[model samples]
Target: MTVTDQTAAVTTAPEIDSEQLRAVLEYYFDQDWTDGLPVMPVTESSLAAFLASTDRDPEEILFTIGHLNRSLSVRSAAINAALAGCKPEYFPVVLAAWEAIAKEPHPARGIWQSTTGTAPFLLVNGPVRTELEINSAGNIFGSGFRANATIGRAIRLGCINVFGLHPHKLDQATQGNPSKYTAVIGENEEQSPWPSFAVEHGYAEGDSVATMFVIRSVVHIEARHTMVPEQLALDFVNTITRSGALIHEYTSTLLVLVPEHAELFANAGWSKDDLRTFIFDNATRPRAELAAVGKDALSNRTRWRLPSDHPDSTPDTASTTDEPDTVRLLSHPSSVQIVVAGADNAGVSAVVEIFTLNPPREIPFSSSRIG
Candidate 1:
């Protein structure tokens, strides 16, 4: 039988854990789905098909997140991807993201099911974006694109169903941003004259991969012919750096520079570093501004009272230092991330995708050591 046939046969199984149903129904009286209309049961066969496409073994554990401390095996991930309508090729990117999350020891489980923030937003970089047809263009986060939507949904479902991060249960998002369901994947700069976002994270200019982060929201910097390139970038950074940006001093931001705005910078010969540093340095909201936006912990930087003196240096900086003088976030300008994407028509517009950490800079995209 063909892989598709085998997968379809197994995926059609009629099984939904009655216990889980009982639990969820009792909680959400007016839940999204009605009594009979539930999600497809995640089965094993379809999952195997997804794993088969990846170089990793099916049983390989990618990462564990949230309350259940559920292990993300390649097998389980494949099934999640399948349910989310992901193509077989999208598995590796998904797997890599799980790997990346596992590396982020901030207890993502709480983040996934928190009333405070949304789960980590997944961003695709490299050749995988095109090979899978992810939307990094005009309708980028507006839905309607398959790869643009499903890959992100797969991860979300995995967190919700597999990891048991249901709202109020584990996720505590008070006013969590809307980009949670949206794929904020950035397009490659190679397509234009700019260097790719992943390149800033150390990926070669042409590698294919995925990046995941805990993003709060995204906004745009609209510029016109009246605004020069430098002014335009400054404006883009200025616009996105307001209230939500400083909710926490320890965020890794993912910036999206649309083609129209990118061209202006390209014309003026602005290197990636120049843009990143410019935004990072100028994106500052004063300590008072952060507190006004409900980030009371904003001024906690560098003020950590660490047992008198546990060795002092750059850790004394108010930006990266934490309680007890701990250096939890980046101590310098290298903490921000930037990417160039969007329509080339506008001449000076950009879609900025923001993250809590500087984001997935795992160097040299992982190759299939054993496909």
Candidate 2:
């Protein structure tokens, strides 16, 4: 459908002086449209610039929160992008991130409504990383880069303005983390020992892609004392299988390796696959350890039980022999996603724990090619 026809039902804002930034900010704040921060005025020229960057029809539906019956259009996304202070050239990456989220099997249930305080963690790959100046080095997750900050903010703003997922209302995060505001980084493909994450996922090496992961927490791993790959891998495994972090057997983790750490593994002739296998093989905890965190009963009832005449029988039932003494943290080796990023100076890495409230199923990793 055309932009004019599709946006007919969209509520129009009252005319405000585009030149008066203070008045525009106040207007949006009063309407509960801002994310507790100053937002750029959504001017006609700015919106037009954002729209011109993408070939998609302005009213094309990007995704819908099925339960709320709220659909986000390309035009609405552009509006949020403008409000988030994104450059017009960054619109395609924003749309691609949303497209990746929409491709998930159950975005509304699995992502938007989770009380675990999960937020979209975006990874930009390919030449667009350099084109937009998305930071892949030196405090990559920290503040500085406009493209990284605004692109992520655009997604959060859409969740608030378009879907009404306001905190203490629809978004019932117990304790949201810093990443809830913005979390995006580019893959340091230039300094990496392997191909870009997009290429590994079957996209062409030249293709720019945006990948989305709904994460609950990020734990930093420091291994400054060791040059051994096994030692670093053990540190990562320890972080991954920590008592507080291991909430499910099918939990997935994104291991973001700094250039220095990546080099340590590469020097040892270890491929990404080898590192993944090592992590999967060693990141296990004894079933008895669950009792230390008061999760034994829950684990037994949900995962170690047998099928009976109960109507709501879970499919994760295990046979007597299938129930091993030690429980694996991840479902498979591939669950430990490896990506190289950050400056070459640090021996630091980060383990991003995926949202796994609904477990015993494959976690959908979503990626879309950037325009």
Report the C-alpha lDDT of model 1 over 1-371, residue by residue, as the tens digit. 99999999879978878798767655533443211223444456666678678667778787765456477788877777776777777777777777766665544536555565655666667776767777777766676777777677777767765666555555667876665554546574545677665665667766765665665556655567544656776676566555544434344455576666666677788777777677666654554444344443422334322322234212223444343322233334455556666666665344444333323232212222112
Per-model TM-score on C-alpha atoms: 0.72, 0.88
Q: Where is model 1 poorest over a 10-residue stretch in terms of lDDT? A: 362-371
Q: Which 10 successive residues of model 2 have the least lDDT summed?
A: 312-321
Score candidate 1 by lDDT.
Answer: 0.58
Model 1 stretches astray by more than 4 angstroms? 1-44, 66-68, 107-109, 182-186, 225-227, 250-252, 284-331, 347-371
User: lDDT tens string, model 2, 273-299?
Assistant: 999999989977765675556543334
In candidate 1, position 19 carries an lDDT of 95
